[model samples]
Target chain A: MIIDINAFLGHYPFRRLPHNSARTMIELMDAHGIDSAVVSSLHSVFYRDAHRGNEDLFLETKDFGSRFVRVATVNPKYVSWRRDLDEAMDRWKMKAVTLFPAHHGYLLSDVECQQAIEEIVRRDIPLVLTQRLEDRRQRHHWDAAEDLEFKSVLELVRQHTKLRLALVNWIGLDGKRMAEAGLQGRCLIDFARLHVLLNKDVDKLISSLGITSIAFGTHMPFDYVGPSLVKLANLESNPAIDYPAVSWRNAARFFGLEGGD
Target chain B: MRKIDVHNHVFDAVDQPGANWARVESMIEAAEWLGIETLCCSRPITGGAMAEIAEVRRANDAVLATMQRYPDRVRGFCFIQPGNGRLAIDEMQRCFDQGMIGVKLYNQFKYADPMVYPIAEKCIELRIPLLGHSAHLTDARSIAAQPMTSDSLEFCKLATRFPELILILGHINGGGDWEWAIKGLRECENVYLDTSGSVLENDTIEMCVRELGVKRILFATDQTMEGCVGKILSAQLSSEQREDIFWKNAHAIFARRTS
Candidate 1:
């Protein structure tokens, strides 16, 4: 079963963009052979902080049952961080948390930020950090979302050695230099953009980094499902290496769902 | 799904950069996924006078290498760098001798850029088709920054001089920049619209197919920066229109091989 780790659930800035409803999103996922997804809300990333998005996520996941896994998005800079996170954890039963450092404008190395990360790690929930959602070249609505500060992320990972950080939107070209600099296995990465790299090249990266380091992600509403599905189907390599593990097995293990198989 | 990708690139093994090889392999994998057949041109051919003859030769060799690496999946064009008419003629002759199919020109430079005219004339003389980039230079903002407008007009003039030569105005889908080129080529029987480039919302193909016939529209994917075959399939065209645009017309143009 494929699990999309990069999926989103809330109304984004796309007030005019044609998109699938929650029900249609499930249908499209099924159409593309994706069985389950771990989703967050863009609204949570934008306004009312992660607390509000987490509330909406709980509501949305209710209809999908186990098909939709909830990830609470929190603003490290928010004043009510501890209270909001405690409520999200005790009430909503969230398994993971996503951080929007760029949107929230908080450095990963901020002392207060480290406290928040510590709280999330203390709860044994995986932390997902989204880099950027759209291509910078595309016409944008505003200047808020820009290129992510990779150095800050690297530093954060180095400081919190035991934290299970999920870097969503991993790519073949961009993060390779860091991987060479000893950043390979510590963070769990989503494979939404890896579709751009296929065949023997994909095999090389997989052999070097175990399947557990990967996570399948759809980057829904922004990216079309066809390209990602087409690439995954045609990926060339040893069957075991190219098999669906990054998004499915990795998330399953991280979320304590051994019965996902 | 028999399909033709109008835009692509290849480089010589000896001269090709490592990153470029990786990019090409990735692109080939992408093409295989969509069951596409692609026509690859050399960087020298696409980049025009900016390329040297030796570099063009290496690029030609690279295109030959890519064709060899993926047999039956790739076709090629004899790229002519600007200002080298003698070399362009020599390259055209070599292409024919080496079994290359057509010609490609980046028509974004000065229309009458002295170096380009000879190649245009040579293409006409050789009876080979040339795919030209056409964007409008309505003002200076896009002109100095882009390589699209005036060159298309020059290409049209050459096409008028040689009626038998097949000239395709590429990226008709490129908004405003090439709108005039599209309008100008509508009256030219020998000139066709190669539907390729950017993810534009405006429906250029519909207008081309309506004003000109389906026979005049050729499907192309600028695969380096875009998805080659998937883009062709993604177009908001009818199945019949897509079928003709994607395969039939291209097959008819490069008719020698069994692609």
Candidate 2:
């Protein structure tokens, strides 16, 4: 199945998002032949109260059912995170949790983050970390969100043993650092930002970082799905890459979808 | 419908040991999904912060070789550094003689700088477009690195100076403020923006169409092939408008050679 591991719903402040609604998003996915998308709310990344965005995310995708793998955006800094996260997982069926440490103003090292990480680990749910959801350089003038640093992820991997960390957007660029951080099995990455055809980064990365580490993502609605599809086209040509693995198998495993791995 | 990629690059992969049509074919094959019919390719100087005249010549030579090798598919864009002064103009002439369709400028000099005027004049005289490497950088550090980087603002400035110049501000989504870049480009009828670069902001292509009209926008990848192709494909443009941006506009620029 073609799955977009990183997708979103909700209005982006900078640009008019035509495909933000569930029906429009599905139409876009069908137009692109994407079978499923792991979706969270875009406002969740910036909202002061994480549950507010999660509530919106659940509301948006509730009609589509499992066609959208609802991922709750959790701010460990928020006091009622534990209860809200449980409600999102149990009540809303948000199968995965995404953390915007850079946006929410907490490092993976923070005490609250560690607590949330432990709880997520206990539940055996994947914790996805998004970096630079919007290109920081192109962010709206007043938006102060910074790109999540690579080292912060390294620290997360180094510290949390069972954390199934899924890195998204440009954060997944440095395969070398990821290889160094030992981010193969437990950690997964989306390929929206990885350059395959133009630069040899993806080829070199797959050789070293292993093919299973990468999965399909387009940063859709917020961005276009075209680039990831292009990257996928290039990857499919490489005999070394297992097309199915990057296409959907690894993503299924990462996001706890059926038929994964 | 034919799609022309007006801004793309060829690395030294062709010069690598035992390099064959396979490398070029792979690029074309990769773009088969997007059906990229023609690629206007250039190899800008890779090693240095600024390119010298010799380096500029070598880059153009690389472009010439690609164009020759894939004559039907590849169109050469002569990459030059205006700082090379007389030699740069001469190099542009040499590439034009070799059938290069346009001039590709890196951050070696600003588009509005006096040094670039001679090259702009050369492009105008030859009826070839001058595609400037551009970005509207906001941060201080990035600005520090590519200080000579031209943007749509500078392209407009240059177009104002040379009204007939077919000036292309390369990669609106390349980086920095695209809203700023696209807005700045509206008044300069002579300046066109290529759809390339990595960032595929939703409505960016539509915004360009809204502001600049379909005739002036060019389809380009700048090596970020999929993103750009995707941007245009997913845009709120009709098939005819898509064809116009993807092929006709580039066809016009490449066909405009006088001598």
Candidate 3:
């Protein structure tokens, strides 16, 4: 069974997604052999108060049961974010929380963000940070959502060594640098945007940074899932590497959902 | 269907590690995994950016060597810096004489620059396609690093000036206004948009097929084979159209080369 760590539901304001609804998303996943997915709401990216978006995501995935895990969004820019996060964890039972620093106009170093990270760590819930939602070149002509500063995120991760942070949509030199900066076991990287792994460097990356911290994530609806699947297939062909660990085991262990299925 | 990747780089750069013969072999394995039959490889622009004319020649020679090694699986494109002027033209001839299939113009000079005309004319004379790197950004600050970056409009202008030259405007999906870039090349019959670049947005390939028919679009991975295949598969095109973009068009275009 495959567990996709980065999937989204709801409309993307920039371009129309082929499968934006939960039903279509599930159908898409099933067609692609995805057993379960940790999904967030695209609405939360643009919303001023991300709580409403989180509530929408909760309602969307509530009926899907374990097949679809809800990942709530909390914008530290809002003053009542801590309450929203608590409600998401306690009431909605969200297993993860995602942060859009670029869209929400804040840095990972912000005090509110730090407090939220601490709260999430205290609750043992994973924190997923989307480094970028859309490709910088493809952003709307007027949309000014810059990429989240990698230095700031690295600094934050350094401070919170035990924090379970999953950096999503980061690839190439930056991703490699982050991994090389002693983030191998400390932080997890979503494979949805690691295009370089599709090349000959897959084995090199695996050797340098073991497969434990890498997780399967297909930024579905925003990005096609086929590429990640291709990367997984390539990894599976190699007998030396543990493809299952990256496919689902790592994510399963990270979310503490191991042995449930 | 058979596939020919028209925009693949095969070189080890100073900054990007693991770019060696073993790496290219792994890339070829990955491409073969997806049923790609041939990769028309060229040295990456980053490799030629800091090198002297002799180094550039050595880089092209390395590409030729890889082609010779792979024979059926790999084809070499002579990468030239138009700024080298007469020496660039001579190097193109030298590589062509040594079995290089086509010309790959990097971002050393704009597609619209007069310096590129001689190279375009050389490609036309050699009956080879010129694969020029094209992006859509107009912001001076963004392109300050690679000042020679050309947009599709510049390609259109270049095509108009050299009607006989077959200009393959590469990387339509490389983080620029691709819609405008694709549309700008609508009337230029000799210009083809390659499906390369890193970002593969939904409907991008289909949109390119819609604006410029499948005959004018060539499948390319830019050395990112898996992602490129995903982009092509995600496109809502029929089997015939897929075949055309995947290999037929590339075969038809590159077949005319004297080499």
Candidate 4:
């Protein structure tokens, strides 16, 4: 069973996405053997107030039940973001929250951002940070999602030792740093951007970092599921690594799901 | 099904001293896992910056040596630094003599530059395809970098000048407006789009197949075989269309030098 920690719903304003609807998302997950996914809304990305998109996401995935778990977004740039976070937690029953600091034009070091993260920790919910929505080289000409500085994210992770964090869409050397920093076991990383294929780099990562801190995340709707699955499948062949842990066990455990499916 | 990867790099890391050879080995293993039959390998243009003619020769020689080591699995492309006019031509001749099949031009100079015309003429005379690094220019930052980079429009201009030369627009998915890139090169039949680079946007492969026929798209990984092949496999295309992009088109394009 595959549990995708990073998936999205709603339309990406710049390009055409194949599985933007809830139905198509489920179809894609089923086709790719993804049992469950933590989904955020792309509407949250473009809309000025992410609370509206969060509400839309909650309404959209509420019907699918356990197959799709809602991961609401809160743009801390808003003055009333704390109230929105409360509604997302208590009213929406979102399993986790996603921060688009870059898109929202705020630093992770901002007081509001730190307070929101502290609250997320207080609630005992996981916080997923999407480092980038699109490849830096291929961002849309008019408006592109700026990336959150890696050093800033590292600083946030170091300060909030009690917070459960997972970073998504980081690639190459940045991914290596995330894995190294995740040694604390409080933070985890999604394999979608790592592109760890069958190689010594992944092997070393599994051996040194431990497989429990790694989770499968497909940046779907914007990206394809095939590469993430292929990476997982390739890593599964090594006897030293645990495929179940990376694929679903770690995510299920982190999100407090029962039995890891 | 057989597959040919047109855009692949073979270089040892100068920054990370000990990691070079292992990286190359891992790349080959990854290619084998993806079932790629032949990889057109060249020394990455970005590596070592290719600032001097000697560096260019060293990079091409490295590719030649790699091709020799794995004759059946690998094909070499002589990377040229057009700024080194006469030396670049001599290196191209040397590479051809050493059984290199094609010429690889990177961001050293724009494809439309007068310095590149001689290289294009040589490729035509040698009956070899010229693989060029091309992307869509977005802003002033990219415009300033244009002396070393070529967008699809530049490639279109180059193709118009040399209609007989087979030009490949490498990484049509890399940056800028891909729709503009595709439309800009739509009239240039000699120019082909390489499906590589880091951007695997949904329906991009389908868009390429729709705009440019299946034969015009070449499946390439740009060193990340799994990621690249995954993009092709996930593309919503018919089996025949997949075959054409995966192997048939590449085979036809590369078969020219032999013919």
RMSD of each: 6.1, 3.0, 3.5, 2.7
Q: Provide TM-scores for the models.
A: 0.73, 0.90, 0.89, 0.93
lDDT of 1 by residue, A1-261 (tens): 777777777676632322334676787677567887777877787785668778877886777777777888888788898898888778877778888877788777887789998988788778887777654333233635654666777677677766777777655433564465455655567655554343343445555555566666657755555444544554423356546565377778766565544
Q: Is candidate 2 or candidate 3 better by TM-score?
A: 2
**Model 4 residue A233 lDDT?**
77
- Every model's TM-score on chain B: 0.82, 0.93, 0.92, 0.92
What TM-score does prediction 4 earn? 0.93
User: Who is ahead in lDDT, 1 or 4?
Assistant: 4
Q: Evaluate all candidate structures by whole-model CA lDDT and list the values in order.
A: 0.64, 0.82, 0.80, 0.81
Q: Which segments of candidate 4 are over 4 A away from where they belong? A: A141-144, A172-183, A198-201, B13-20, B47-50, B139-147
lDDT of 4 at B154: 89
Cα deviation in Å at residue A178, candidate 3? 7.2
How do the residues B156-204 of candidate 3 rate in per-residue lDDT, one tens digit apiece? 8899999999889998876676777888888888799899887766677
Task: Summarize candidate 2's per-residue lDDT along B67-169 as a digit string, tens digits.
Answer: 7778888888888888888988889889988898898888877778898899989988898988888888877666777778888888988999999999889
Which candidate gets the maximum TM-score versus the true structure?
Answer: 4
- Greater-lDDT candidate between 1 and 2: 2
Clashing residue pairs in candidate 4 (N, C-alpha, C atoms within 3 angstroms): none
What number of clashing residue pairs does each candidate have, in the order they appear?
12, 0, 0, 0
Candidate 2 collision pairs: none
Candidate number with greatest DockQ = 4
For all the predictions, what are the DockQ values? Answer: 0.17, 0.50, 0.38, 0.51
